[model samples]
Target: MTFAAITGWGAAMPPNVLSNADLSTFLDTNDEWITSRTGMKERRISHVGATEMATLAAKRALACAGVDAKDVDLIVFGSCSPDEQVPNSASGVQVAIGATRAASMDLNTACTSFLYSLSTANAMIRTGVVRTAIVIGVEHISPYMDWGNRNVAVLFGDGCAAVVVQATDKEEGLLGEQLGCVADARHTLRVRGMGSGYTNSGVMLGDTEWDFDGQEIFKRAVQGMVQASQAVMQKCGVTPDDIDLVVPHQANLRIIEAVVQRAGLPMDKVMLTVQRYGNMSAATVPVALNDALVEGRVKPGALILMPAFGAGLTMCSHLVRWGDRVTPIATIPDEMPASKLSALDLVNKIRDRKSQSHEASHDGLQGARLIGAK
Candidate 1:
């Protein structure tokens, strides 16, 4: 039987850091309050576009696997914040990496995008549709974020990561996963004014306001992640103790802890990047996975569990079986240029731009007139 094996992994984090202290400059909250509540100390801000970070991550992943772009058969770019809405971001990465003969597409399921894209590529490889594929989990959320809103403003960052999965008979890639969504609860979390439904109403493209119910999101997120994690573990016939490491989405510290406790896992067994990177949405799981391997937390022939929840109230749990190799076969020197400003300054600039034009935009951005949606 054919199976998919993850042969390579790489991540790209921006040079700028946005600390909780920086957030205190404008908002009423301070470092102690933010840290005590969310377990998040800092996040990142990008000086470039989403496509650029994804391209760098793809190059590093391709090099790590010792695979050439021309040999790749598929590329799955998983992100909600792509550089362009029409052309598809996966195609941009394909061209950037010179994957001339590869088929490319984008997938967006909120924070679960990376894992879902991984499932897509794995299924295709197993069915003989594609041999080698690149799966990316990237988010450039700073641009669309409502920085003035303290509720959701402190919970996100910008980052990217990619993995190379290839056909194998070893059964060492994604063994099982439980995918689902809480559609009835979807209205609890939403970013207004992005889709054509609003842009068609004469609103600016990136102008956005968030609707976040902290209590509802927290309740639903923990329930979804815990159930999905337990279900996948049972499907794979593995218990919590069998999991070598749990690399979960870094949306909120409380959410992660709640999921782990309910799923019967230990805190020490989880790989955390929340305190440093906050929530990069779809980029969360892959970046945490990449960090695990880099920190030597991932071992040869290890069992890893990845659980995540995103907007649309989408949720999932992916169980991965590691292969014999943990080190990169090759490396790339590719990197993003250093940012010229601090995270706070960059955020301030965004706030300033929105303050100037968002009110005028908001008057028109309220209704749904998207071309394809009702």
Candidate 2:
């Protein structure tokens, strides 16, 4: 039987650090309050586009696996914030990495996009549809972010990560997974004025209003993640004791604690990047996994559990068994373009641009209206 083995992994974090102190300059919250509530001290603001970050991550991942771009058969870009909606972001990465012969796809399941893309690639590789694949979990949320809203403003960051998965005879990679969604609670977390529902609804492109019920989302996220994790473990016939590491979505520190604890796992067994990076949406799990490997936390033949929830109210948990190798086979000398702007300045620029766009489109947007829906 063929199994998809994750042979390589890499992450690209932006250079700009948006500290809580910086946020406090404009918002009513301070570092201590933010830290106490969400466990966030600082987050990143990307000076580059989402595709560029994903490209850097992909190059590093391909080099780590010592696999040439020509040999790759597939590329899956998992992100909610794509650089372009039409051409698809995966194709951009494919071209950037020179993966000429590979097929490309973009997937969005909110924060669980990376895991879902991983699952997709794994299934294809196991089914003989592809031999090698690159799976990217990336998000560029800064542009669409509503800086005026303190509730959700301080909780997100921009980042990207990629992994190389190849066909293998050994029993490794994603063994079991449970994918689900609470559609009824979908309204709990939403970014209005972004999707097709608002296309002709007099909504400005950069003008967004978030429908976030924090307490309700907390309750649902924990319940969904815990249930999914338990279900996948049972499907794979593994107990909590068998899991060597837990790489979970970093939406909130409290939620992470509650989910792991409910699954009978200790905090030390989990890999956390929330305090430093906040929630990078789809990038959360893969970036945390990359950090774990870099920190020497992942061992040979290890068992890793990844659970995540996103805005579809989408939730999932995956069980991945590692192979013998934990170190990269090679390295790529790639980096992001230099940026002289501070994090606050970059954020303010985005805010100003958004404000300008809203102002310019004010009349036209007001005239636009939903045509089909009642």
Candidate 3:
């Protein structure tokens, strides 16, 4: 059967870096507290919109694939931090990136979003639906973070990773994929508000809060990923020893190590970007894939396995044959420009916006009172 091959990959992160030391200043926690728990020193966060990060990554990915945005047949953007709650975020991405010819939409399965998109894209390509597709995992996790709470606050970062999947006759593209979801434990990690069902009364409750059971999430993620990885390996008729590299969701360092141990895979076989970028949710796997590709760790015919588990209690695994023979269209620089906003600057901006909105509402109410008096 024809398969979808990842022809290009790219990742983009905000200029601002929120280090463990910086986080400790606001919360009662210190760098050691975070590092021990998460194995993360810092994470990238966007001061700009989610579209900006996704667009930058998509551009680089398309450039690397040697294809223009106009040539894309489909675009699937995966994220929890969407541009708006009503309209899909992929539409905004399509307009911003000038991908008028491509069909587009957004998919959300929490951190497992990218893998879900990858499975769907592969099916579409195999069925002769689309020749070239762009799959992106973009998250503006900062806006959704509860900065006042240290638990969820320090665990997330904003970033985007884009990959170009194209149909190829060679067997070295996507080989096999397996997906599993545990709906019984859906509430283990979730955001409380901002949905059609919630806002139907038009009372305008504004932004919702993110709620998560950290310990429960950690346990579930580790268990789910381990099971999913084993299932995928079985389906592909390959053992852990046959795999050259394993790219996993960059949720926590401990989780990665746990899954590796359970799968009986050596630590050296795992690819990680959690230390530098923290948890970008759905963007984690692709970002790690891009990092490995740029470092020339991936070679043609190498068997690469990717697994992800996320908030829905969702899990997905992909078995791919690394196609290094096809030259990359472009490559990201070893270093990119930094972000313009600091974490403090971002906080100030949020405060200023809230203040201005409140003042404007007060003025409107006073104007209505004056009109009533007349």
Could you estimate the TM-score for every candidate?
A: 0.94, 0.95, 0.89
RMSD values, in order shown: 4.9, 5.2, 6.2
Instruction: Please write out the lDDT profile of model 1 over residues 231-346, one tens digit for every residue.
Output: 99999899999999999998889998999999999999999999999999999898999999999999999999999999889999999999999999999877788666777877
Show how many residue pairs clash in every candidate, following the order shown. Answer: 1, 0, 3
Q: Lowest lDDT 10-mer window, candidate 2?
A: 364-373
Which ranges in model 3 have alpha carbons more than 4 Å from their true place? 200-206, 331-339, 351-374
TM-score, candidate number 3: 0.89
lDDT of 3 by residue, 278-307 (tens): 999888888888888888778778899888
- Residue-level lDDT of model 2, residues 1-374, one tens digit each, is 99999999999999889999999888888998899999999999987778889989999999999899999999999999887777788888887778989999999998899999999999999999999999999998887788888999999999999999999999999998999999999989888877788888777777777888989989999999999999999999999999999999999999999999999999999999999999999999999999999999999999999999999899999999999999999987778776778889878876666657756343322111212214
Structure candidate 2, residue pairs in collision: none
**lDDT score for candidate 2 against the true structure:** 0.90
- Which residue window of length 10 is worst by lDDT in model 3? 365-374
Q: Higher TM-score: candidate 2 or 3?
A: 2
- Best TM-score among the predictions, by candidate number: 2
Q: Which stretches of candidate 2 lie over 4 Å from their true place?
A: 358-374
Query: Which candidate model has the greater TM-score, 1 or 3?
Result: 1
Best-matching candidate per lDDT = 2
